[model samples]
Target chain A: MQWSTLIVFLLLFVLVTVLGFVAAHWRKADLNQLHEWGLGGRRFGTWVTWFLLGGDVYTAYTFIAVPALVFGAGALGFFAVPYTIIAYPIVFAVLPRLWYVAHKHNYVTGADFVRGRYDSPLLGLLVAITGILATMPYIALQLVGMEVVISALGFPMSGWAADLPLLTAFVILAAFTYTSGLRAPALIAIIKDSLVYITVIATVVIIPMQLGGFGKIFAAVPPAKVLLAAPVGQSLGMYSAFATLALGSALALFIYPHVLTGVLSAKNARTLTRNMAFLPAYTLVLGLLALLGFMALAAGVDKVPQYAPFFKQYANSFAVPALLMHSFPGWFVGVGFAAIVIGALVPAAIMSIAASNLWTRSIYRAYINPRCTEAQEASQAKLASLVVKFGALVFVLALPATYAIQFQLLGGIWIIQILPALVFGLYTRWFHRYALALGWLAGMTAGTAIAAHLKFAGSIYPLHVFGYAIPGYAALYSLILNIAVAAALTVLLRLLGVAGGQDQTTPGDYRAAVPDRDSGAGDGQMAAPPTL
Target chain B: MTTRQSSSGIHPRLWWRLLLLVPIIATLWVPWYNHLNPTFIGIPFLYWYLLMWVPLSAVCSAVVYFKTRDLV
Candidate 1:
């Protein structure tokens, strides 16, 4: 029954639990302050920021689902690599500026940055609400990642029975995240990244060897599935769809409030720059993980004796785990499963903290209690993190685990709509605040409607206009209309003399670096604005 | 309520900003490289084409990062 494997996983889980709790005191900041609790005092050094961000961004289901796509469909799954490739350079272009302005204004969340930049509370609230909605489902999907591993561990229960153990695992995650905030995930990222390295390496090197070689693996895939040629005729969109999916997702990745939380928490601009330089190493790992799907196919996973029964019932999401369970001994199977489980927990911690920070900074303080102090903000965010995690739990329970994938897909599309008001607004304020909001509305509606119309979880939807399929990703198509609407409306609004609201940022603020002097950085720099 | 200013060498900013186009524009046209007839160690052109850009993107970001560090 693999009890020994279960015990090994439990031991590692216990070790990470201790680390999560101890992280509350890691940098020794006053935990009562919102910045400290919500952002690890926004002082993560280079390697810490690397691990924390590496852990936060490349999530758990991604560890499973990317490979699952390759296993099920073939080369199309490799889109994740190009998407990630463009992502770092994009980060290089704009995120440092975001960090600079966010730090200058003592803004703890992306919504707070939106509020300060556009000087519009309603725009900030829209960003905050969108961030919370996108992140909640995403957090729920992490549980789905963990849930797949738990069910794969020889427990074949379905429906409500499958979720009980997951609920328990999430409760422990919620407890530690509530107490420790970003620090918990920062410390746990170390363990998560280490195990991910071991898992990806094993799948990439060992499985290929065991299954003959990559030559034999590619040859084993049916010619149609493995061939890279884009089919001609009405499916011309397939070719461009591949490229645009990567570009669109790359644009969307860092805009997630959780991603911005990681970005904003770095000690300074250079840390972020260095992180972008090396974060591609994680992309390298992702490439290897994507190859694991091919490895699963080559290994003839459905034919493996141990996994044959489960193979008949489940989807390709279990391919890598099944490969591990089939190849490695039970204890290593436990270690691999533990890696996936820990991977989910790390992001769940960071995302709840990021989401709750949005709730506290942009929603609660702006609406519920305008007079809230620093300590109150921290406590409110702490309490809100639990609520966010609880919401994630309910989301996971209400939607079938299968539908959980739809939520994850929707997150990328939903979060990208905020770019005009949130990201482009970083570089130029040419976009009027209302025009930005309208852009967000058009983009969100188009993106969500297209995704929902397909009623499928994967990215390929033939965008047929007048019965002719167009070549593009859903987000890219929406982004086209998003910018068009924002630009045209911006010119129209400016002509009518609509006030663009106050810009609380200065041009110099974008280029200012944190001082080399370490004293009183981050904690004492916050100056409350009179206008808000 | 204070403003800080530092002049950038227009040279480095211009260079790095231009460097960003290496990945973004290179990947924009996918059909150019979407062939598998020329495989690399059993990897298709489609897969290796994208993987090739991963390191390139990193190099571009690293260069931009160093160039911009002086401003911040």
Candidate 2:
């Protein structure tokens, strides 16, 4: 192990661990309440929400994988930039309504909203279970990211000894999350984002200058890697793939349990909307980070003797780490590596908290113990978060990293299946509850079948529409089928005179205004209704 | 609560909010900006063009947010 780098990394790791535990008292709330622990009492203002959401969305795995994808596959990997950019406008238009309604009802998970909206406890359970399934591998993938950085620090790579450090890191993570809940990640996200900004800025400036300039960097990349190949025929080959990936990912990004948890934790709808306006700042940084793949290619990191062993082990995933080790000093390498490892902890913490919220609110309370007290519910969530993190830890240690990635691919496909029931339900309750569930089943089945047909090798499926091949994201394709099924069945169910479930929310809930400053109506408390 | 405001329709005052869709449509139509020339600071046209939209999209959302602040 490199002593200086390991020392610096350990120092920062210890710092964040302390921050995580200390965050429980940061906001000074009763930790026994579910909302206080799971949603930070819904009290995060614009800046805190900005940092929290940024850290939550742009994950550590994303930091490693996006550039790795770009390094390997070229312009197609740049879809992340447009995906993040497109996400905000959609968030601006849709999520404030969700935020407003969630605040009014104290809904903690998307499934809670779905359950309340359709008056279907079964549907709520489905959403909750689907969320948990999708998130577990996602949490595991964060471990894979941490593994990359940890192993890059010259730790053990295999055997029981290798997993010891990961296990220790996670035990500490579980402890802080259990003690502090969402506050830990929200507090730690601030430092994570600051370090990320410094790392990205320093890398962009120093690396480009060292390698001659941006001109030389682009010149070093192969011609095919510089721009997307134009569609030769009616196929719309990579073009459609790029566009649909951007669109489908944007649509699915905010719907994830972790992202929605970030949204629901905001102080009010206005905070969410204002954040939508500014959150694209992360997208800008993400775009520049994607270009670093080209820089790594230019620098010939794979050819370097010192990093060749890592490149052989990790392939493209080692690009960023190798670049850092090759370029930065040992101490600054510690800071950058610490930034990435802390980045993993923030999202892993949030995802577990979100999954546990899904369990305690929608499944446990909704099914097992209807009369559980608020304190009991909060305790249940704390324990459930620990269980969720442990399950992910086992998933990473017992299985290959490829298995986590495959499951994560399926996770995206499965999570987006709920969009028809969740997102559409936000605007209107025209869909029959049973029909929505059926659509979810069809989408999940179809998405899984398509991915399996492709041997789970990729997310894009080539569709022959009237013999014209159009390859696009499997999520969007299945989502189309989902909407079609939901609409057709809704009409059929309406014709059969079947009852659509009652919506527990009202129109005013979607547009609830903040109370006047002196009114003593708290952050999530309903204001006096304005006359229509 | 009154049922006068229907869920299906956007209020006329909030029509400006549709401007938010501009970025979504523009970015998703990949063929529009999938070129290599007109490079900015040696970054390819496709790369810099999409990056430019990052900030521009924020401005679009910001405009929509300020416009609809009082309404919602």
TM-score of each: 0.92, 0.94
* lDDT (Cα, tens digit) per residue for candidate 1, span A194-268: 888887777677777887777888888887777444757666645667777788888888898888999998989
Q: Tens-digit lDDT track for model 2 on B3-28?
A: 12243445454777888888888888
- Interface RMSD of every predicted model, in angstroms: 8.9, 5.8
DockQ of 1: 0.43
Q: Could you report the DockQ of all the candidates, in the order they appear?
A: 0.43, 0.48
The 10-residue segment of model 2 chain A with minimum total lDDT is A523-532
Task: Assess each prediction's global lDDT (C-alpha) against the native.
Answer: 0.80, 0.85
User: Taking the tens digit of each residue's C-alpha lDDT, what string does model 2 give over A14-118?
Assistant: 999999999988979999999999999988999999998998778765678788878888898898888999988888888888988888887888998999999
Question: iRMS of candidate 2, one decimal?
Answer: 5.8
lDDT of 2: 0.85
In candidate 2, position A189 carries an lDDT of 93
What are the clashing pairs of model 1? none
Which candidate number has the best DockQ?
A: 2
